[model samples]
Every structure is written in structure tokens, then in C-alpha cells.
Target chain A: MSDTILFDYWRSSASYRVRIVLNLKRIAYRAVPTDLLTRQQKAPDYVARNPQGLVPMLHIDGQDLTQSLAIIDYLDATRPEPRLIPADPVARAATLARAMVIIADIHPVNNLRMLHYLKNEMGQDQAAVDAWYRHWIAEGFAALELMAPENGLFGCDAPDLTDVCLVPQVANARRFELDMAPYPRLTRIDAALQAIPAFAAAHPERVKPA
Target chain B: MSDTILFDYWRSSASYRVRIVLNLKRIAYRAVPTDLLTRQQKAPDYVARNPQGLVPMLHIDGQDLTQSLAIIDYLDATRPEPRLIPADPVARAATLARAMVIIADIHPVNNLRMLHYLKNEMGQDQAAVDAWYRHWIAEGFAALELMAPENGLFGCDAPDLTDVCLVPQVANARRFELDMAPYPRLTRIDAALQAIPAFAAAHPERVKPA
Candidate 1:
């Protein structure tokens, strides 16, 4: 078995966050795509490993770890090189807060499953669903645009947890065709992150299966 | 000014998470209530301290910190007493994963703002809105029931981050009148957590304004 295996889907925001961290730290891991479109993630075998039946389950250190941020925390703890979070406690907290504005506040509400629920169960049409999707990203991005520091290309000169979260979410915003005009700073950061080989490698398009 | 101040609201699941952690750690700090109903959190002065206009912004160590989990991370890093997270990296990751199941997946979907949006924007009736609220909790609690461990009093021997998050969510579930019959393990854990003085004191009702 490889030292690490990431069960992922190309389009999952959570999965993308971990991929960015892994690439940024140069950790070698084999990717095993759990295609979300086909409900492969809901398979009995996959659920046995992660009770949540969620994608981006990382098998490492002889254990199966779920939750993207938690997996990133493990990687940062084990591989301290090119630290994903800042060394200063306050900065670390702020970075994490910035990350959660996406992870907790924005991403989950606009999750594929959520959109599906809105459509299938709640009888929301595509236009309504799309509006709901953009509404959240806009709400979150508005705050993040103001909160993000001008210290570096992203939140800081060096990519931290915030950028790991930002790039994937911005990708999703584009997928939904949410206007990027309101978030110039976020757009600039995304552009900067795209130039980095690590962030570039983790892009959904790069990981998508042919 | 006191070294520490917590801008909080009684019913916010995010704020409740931080209050539970503070009480559990016996950290002394003044609570400055920010009334969400009054939109006090969105006030210019409050927004200056926390751009997100969210409650449970902790002002400590000569800085203002947002996000409940981020604030808790700062506390766990600085205080390190009766540690809220496990010492081991893998264990910490699992605890955080369990916590995020509530933080990211469950809580945000059922937040007050979302409910308001459902009513005002979507024209959802009270019945429909309540159903929406309960639906997310049931979905999350079902998974959490299996993810939680068979350990002592709390999720583990001592209530860790998982329990801090779990108890508040269960409280919200109860308030929403969500059917709890399906999640026996979570119910048991919440009951056990309630006996802890810290958890008891942090209950929403206990913190309600006179």
C-alpha cells in the first residue's frame, strides 16, 4: 500500500482543499477517485471506512481520516516543511477563521448534495438553485474580500490554510458562473495561486478523470 | 480593558461552542452579548472588530479573533489545560473531523439567517421552514451517531472538541423539536455532557437575557 491514499472527487471543494495542501507540502499520495456523480461515495465499502460517507477520506499512518481540514491538520503536524498554517498563534487563528468562512459558512450550503436536495426534495428549479448557490458564495466572498490581508499574493506572502480553501471555492464560484467582478482581491489571489505549481497541480481540471 | 472579552449571542451554535470551551477550560473572560435579533453584530463598531459580523468573536492576546473553531484553537494553544483536543495528531484529526460534521455540515444550514432567507426569499411557511431545519440535523446526527466513539462520559473520557460541538448542536435540535429517536448514541452523549458544570452553564437558556 502507498504511504498515503486520498479518496477524492475532482469537483469537491473539500477534496480540493486537501489536494492543495498535499501538493504544497510535496507529500506523495495516490489518488483514488470516488466519483460523486454516480453516488460511488455512498457505496457500502466506502461508508465502512468513513461513516460520514464523504469524499476526501485520507488513509495514512495506518488510519482512515475524514474531514478535509482535519486531514490538512494531520499533514501540517506530520510534515512541518512549508507549513500550511502560520507559526504565530493569532495569525494561525485568523488564517483558520478565513478558511472556515469558506469551509463551514460557504461551501457546505452550496454543496452538490445540497443543490440536489433543493431541486429534488424542495422542488427548486435550476435558476432558483443557481441563485441559492451564488447567494452564499457572494455572502462569504464579500467578507473574505475585506478580511484578507494584503501582505502577500493571497492572505499572506506564503500560502497558508486560507489560500488552500480560497482557490477551490473560487473554482466553484466560476463553475456556477457567479460574477467575479465584486471580488477583485479574491480574483487577484486566485490568479496568484494559479501561478504556483502546487496550487496549479491541485486544480480540479488537472485532477479530473478523462 | 480586561485581557479577554467574548462578543457573543446566547443562541448562536457557533457562540455556544466557544462558551462551552471557555467554561470547560475555566478561562476567565467577560461576555459582551451581541444581540443577533437586534442586528447589533452588524453595527459598525462590532464589524470593525469582526468584519464577518458574526458573534463569538474573542478579543484576546491584544487581537480580535473570529470563527468559533479558530477561537478555540487559540485557547487550546495558549491555555493547554484540560486540553480540548487530543495530544496525538491522529486523534486530534478525528476529533476535529467529528466537530466539523457539526460546524460545517449541520450548523450553518440551520442558522437563523438561512431560516430567515427561507421564509422571506423562498416564501416558505413556518411548517416548511421548521421541516428544513430538522432535516439537516437528522441527516447530520445520523452520521455522527456512528462516528462517535464508545468511550466514557463524553465522546471520549474527557469531553473534547467533538463533545463541545455535539452538545450545542443537540441543544439546537431539541429547540427545533427534531425527532431524536434515530440517534441514541448522540442523545446519550448529550445527556452525559449535560452533567458537566461547564456544559450546563453554557446552555442557551442559561445565557439568555433577563
Candidate 2:
């Protein structure tokens, strides 16, 4: 069978993760962009594949996969050579734990729509909204910084799952010009990640949509 | 190996998933409640196990497993008896996809603090905020309902991983008294799930955390 296709949007961090994983694994697949700006996600066809109308849905031989973490893990499971999750169960758990710090804990708190809600609906001033965004990043990063660096170079130098989730969030933080000075370890690990081609190549600007 | 200990708040939808899984597996776990109303999760020691200081930290064989999805999957893998995840590669992707729709899509957008911001800080009345809340749930549930009935009795059948993640969100939706009429299929599955002892016994009130 031929390779699977990925539905993506360049700027979406979730889509960015799938792109990074596909790149890291050296997988050949099509990247289809669903324009977020045009509100295409809310369109009938897009909602059929992903009810939530989110990007980064992977169609592997036709079955649609939602959720970046699930998609990433599925990629790892199907292509196990450069394992994204570590071998030891505990370390794997730790890696996932760190990922949760970013995915479940931090990213959810600072997603695009939430920020919009904070500004348009919550009447939060730009300053308060920015603070709110950074506050969550700082909180999760502090914990991740505390726990990461189990081995050598990157965070959880098994160079596993959590690190994949981390780099994008760090990039997003940088985009907002959130000061990373407070999160020493997270910044350290993120710096290490920046040196890797896999992370750099998968950046949003480099994606097919662009 | 001894059973994992789960520190959870009964009413916390995140914690409720683990309780359901443990029951499904017939795996024994002692439930420790972290007081949400009192903000006990913000306590120092709780912060140590979880840097994010969120409830539903699963202590398994001395390893503190945070993130409900991570914990649930670990059990699904290690135990493997009742297999919450589907076995075929494609089916497995679908299962993960369903779970992610609820976990990544719906829950994050409607979090406690997020809703609180709209209500208290943003000065949107409760009516507007509830509409905002149900809008997301309806968006997600509509997609889930369209899935093959074999996926669960609710969305897919017999309550696989997606259902485990889903039931709690539905519980929260009911708590908010969001109009459940729009998604009759979801309510049908909800009824199917509530009838099962495993899900019924794991309900928030069953946990007895005042």
C-alpha cells in the first residue's frame, strides 16, 4: 500500500507535531492544508473526518486519526525504529508525563480560541490576556524543567515523546515573546532541540501549506 | 505487582476516567481525593508529584503517572485483558482518534478556569457562557455520534478507550445542565454506559468525596 496522507495547517502546533514526526521518521506522505482562516474546518466535509474540525488528522490507508499525541504515538507504534517513547516503562511514563505538562496542562490553557475568548468575551485586557497565557506556560514549564534532563542532551535524553511535544510549545512561547528566562531547564532543553534538524525542518513555515 | 494508587477528586472529570478504567480492568486502586473546592491540589506536596498540581495522578509501582490518558493507556498495554484499545492497527487508530476528540478538543476548551474567565472576569452572563460551553460539546458529540455503533455502545460499543474518556465529559456536560437534546445518539450511548456497573459505580457521587 502507498503512504498515508496528513491533513494539516502550517501554523497549528498540533499539525506542526505531526509534520515533525513524519519528517523525523522520514515518511513519504501527502500534506493537505485545511485553511483555518477561511473557516474551512467548520465546513461539512472537514467535520466528517474530524468532528472537532481540528487539523493534523492523519489518514493512514484511509482511516482518519485525530489528536496529535495519539497520531504521534500511532506513528511511533507503526514505525518503531527511532522510538519516540523510551523502552523502560517508567521512563516512558516520565516522558509522557512531561508531554502532558505541555500538551494537556499548558497548550490547552493557551490555545488560539481561548486567547480570543479571553480578549473578546472575557474583556481581559491585552496585558491580562498575555499574562494569563504566559502564566500557564511558566507553570507547566517550571514543572517540566524540574523533571526533564534525566540523561544527556535534550529533556528526557532518551530523546523521547515529551521532547517532541515540548519544542513546539517553546516556539509558540517565543512567537508571543514570552520571556523564557524563568524556565531555565525548559529553555536549555529547547535550545538543545533547536540544534536538531528534525525539529527545525518541521517548523510551521517549512510545511507544505507554505 | 501491587495496584497503582490514584489521587483524584471525584467531581473532577479527569479523575473519573481512571476510576472507570480501573473498574473495567478489575484492577484495584485506592482513590485519594484532592480537594478541588479548597484548592488542595495547589498544595506543595501534591505539586511535587504533579508539577501542574492537577488531580488524577496515578501512582503505579512507585512511579507517579500523571495525565489520565497516559495512565489509562499504560493500563491498557500492561494488563491487556479487557483491551480498551482495538487490536487491528486501523481500528486502534480510530479508537485513539475518538478519545483525542474528547480529550484534546472538547474538554480543554471548556475547562473550569476558562469558563470562570468568561463568567467572572469577562462579565459575560452565565447564559452566554453556558451556550459557549455546550457549543463545543455539541460540536464534538455530533461527530462521535456518526461513528459506527460497533465503536462503542455510546459512540463506538462496549465502551472502549474513547468511551472511557467520553463518559466523564458527558458527566460534566450534565453537571452544567447543557441541553443534551441536540445529540440524541450521545445521550443513547450515555444511557448504555450508565447501565454498566463499571461506569455506574465509578460515578462522582459513588466516590463519596465531599
Candidate 3:
């Protein structure tokens, strides 16, 4: 067994993504929390580990993988117990592409750093910032809702990698109280995925810190 | 022969990524420029193809695929001319993780919409806005510089998808006059890749509206 450690913050959706995947794979790992509230992730040591100063840096056999999607893909490829990504090219592309809809297009637009700039530098109040965040989530999810086959269960069948990434990001959206009425397909899919033990058990509340 | 048409804008690094992959694979494609500055991508007809209103959407046999990395990966999978992503699990993860260091983390943070907010809504001037763009690029490239293996070429033994993604973003970095001097590994690799036909041919200048 490889010695694996994950430096994570409890509330980070990015960290939340890895947690869901590890739980699904039943990978036993230690979680060393970085308190995001105190901005400890910005500290020098943490910066050394991840110069990007992000959360959920997975130290696998001393190799530190930074991006959550890359880390999860690595876990999927290495473990392969219950696969996260699909096997087929077109299908896998769809799975990964839908997942990136959240990771690349939507999430970054609302992250803490962007919010910090909006509030501190831009002089926007909390309401405006919240609106900005909700706008992008709604935008991305709307497209995802339409694209979802509605023909398959859990991110278009039986809980794949896209399913793993989607739940946490949607959970973040829920925390922000974003209106989900515009995205019925996503909400329905979210309901289905959360019903499964693998996803539900990895909720932020279930983690040790809480 | 497959009917492949790439809807692109010359200056779009996202489109440029696909262009490089197509050239690397020696695939025949026709470039149909979608002028982004004129709100062409947002037109009802174009939006029908891609709801997100983004470019680098590839039309192959009537199906359109958006998102640069997704398109590139699709090309890599279907045509094995020049493999764009690593086949090894660990190594592939490192390559993708390194690539996402730019695609996921840095690029979106400075996306056109995000920059729009930094200027119009956030009240940041050109200098502050340029600083903001460079800040994330520098932070991201710094990590990538460390991530680039010395013995390995182009973040791996061969030029992979990560390298394809890296070059365009680095070129964008140079546009802002960002000092890439600090990140020698990336600058070195950029030099290496840029000198090649695929890279040189995919130049934004080589695309339309230059």
C-alpha cells in the first residue's frame, strides 16, 4: 500500500471532490486539514507544497498532485475498482467534459480569490458577490442540465467520475442558496447521486473535523 | 475521410490548442473563423451549437465539441499520429495535473468575463487588471516550473496534451509582458515547443483576423 496523505480544508469543494472519490474507492488515507478560515493555505509551508496555494494536495508516495481533476483521474487509473471515468472515448469525453463544465468554466468564476477581489478590492458588498457567484453556477448548470441524457442514472449511469465532481460543486451551490429551479435535470441527478452511500457519506458534515 | 471543420478565432488560445493537435496529427481541417469580438459566438445559431458562448468548438461529422482540452483529448484518442496525453497512469496524471495547473486554475481566473468584472464592475484599471492576470499566470507557471521534470521532455518524454495547453497560455503570458524569466523550465519548454512546426504553425498570427 502506498503511503498517501491529503492536505485538505473541510469546506473546500475541490477538497470535497477528492474526499468523495477516495471514499468511493475505499482508499484509506489521512486527511491533514488546512484551515481556510484563517487563510493558513496561504502560509509559506503550504505554498511550498502547492505554490498555487490551493487545497486538497494529495501526497501519494511523496508525489504531490495539485489539480483535483488530475488527482482524481490518477486515483481512478491506479485503483480501477469502481471506475470514476468512463471507458469509451466519446463517453469518457462526455464524462470528463461535463465534469470540466464545473471544474473549469463555473467553479473558478466563483472561488474565494475571485470573491476576495470582488469584495475587498472591487468594493462590492456581500449581496453583489453572492449574485455574481449564483449567475455562473446557474449558467453552467443550465447547460449541463440540458446535456445530461436523462437516459442514465447518476451523471448518465451508475456514478462515474463526472458524478463524483458534480455532487460536491452542487453542494457548494446549495450552500450559497443558488436557485436550482432553472436546472431541473441537475437537481434530479444531484438527488439521485446523494441517495447513494458513497456520495452521502463523504459530505462535509460527515468528515472528522465537524 | 472524416469531415472536420474547426470553428476558431486566431487569437483564441483555446482554438490554437486544437490547431496544434490537428497539425501534430497531420489531420486535414478547415478553419472557419468565429469572430469573438463581434459577439458572433453568442448569436442564437452559434449558441445553439454551444450554450456557453465560447470558441474552439470543433465540428466533426456534424457533432460539435467545445472546450480546448476536451477537443484535443478527443483528437488524441481517435488519431494516434502523435500521442498528446501520456499512457501511464502516474505519468499521465502528472501531465494532466500540470496542464490543469493552467487550464483549470489560472486561465479561468483570468477569463474574458472575469476580466470584464475586474474592470467594469470591480473598477480596476488597466494596470491593476493586467497585474491581476499576471498574478495568477505567474503563480500557476511557478508550480508548473517545479512540476516539469528535468530528464523528461515537455513535461513528459514526448509532447503531450499538457504541453499543448501550456504553450498557448505561456504565449498569452508573453502578450501581457509578464516576466517569464523566473519560470525557466516553462520558458525553456515554451522555447522548445514554439520552435516546432506544429507549435509555430498554430500561432495566433497564423489564424484568421490577424
Q: Number of the top candidate by TM-score?
A: 1
Fnat scores for every prediction: 0.78, 0.51, 0.62
Per-residue C-alpha lDDT of model 2 across residues B106-157, encoded as one tens digit per residue: 8867877667766675577888888778867876787776763733463344
RMSD of 3: 2.3
**Over the stretch A113-179, how does candidate 2's per-residue lDDT look in tens digits?**
7777667765679988887787678767878777766445443444567778888898888987888
- Which residue pairs does candidate 3 place in steric collision? A84-A161, B84-B161
- Model 3 bad stretches (over 4 Å): A42-48, A151-154, A208-210, B150-152
Best by lDDT, which number? 1
Off by over 4 Å in 2: A1-3, A120-125, A150-158, A208-210, B1-4, B117-128, B148-157
Q: What is the lDDT of candidate 1?
A: 0.88
| lDDT (10s digit) by residue, model 3, range B1-210 | 448988898887788888989998998888888987887888998878887778878887456888887777777778877887877877787778778888888888887777776678657799888988888888788878877767555645568877888889998899999998898888778888888898899999877564
Per-residue lDDT of candidate 1, residues B30-140 (tens digit) = 899899999999999988878788888998888899999999998999898888887689888988988899999999998888888878877778988888889889988
Q: Comparing to the true complex, what docking class would candidate 1 get?
A: high
Cα TM-score of candidate 3: 0.92
Docking class of 3: medium
What is the lDDT for A113 in model 1? 79
Q: Each prediction's TM-score against the native?
A: 0.97, 0.91, 0.92
lDDT of candidate 2 vs native?
0.77
The DockQ leader among the candidates is 1
lDDT of the candidates, in the order given:
0.88, 0.77, 0.81
| lDDT measured at residue A121 in model 3 versus the true structure, 0 to 100 | 64
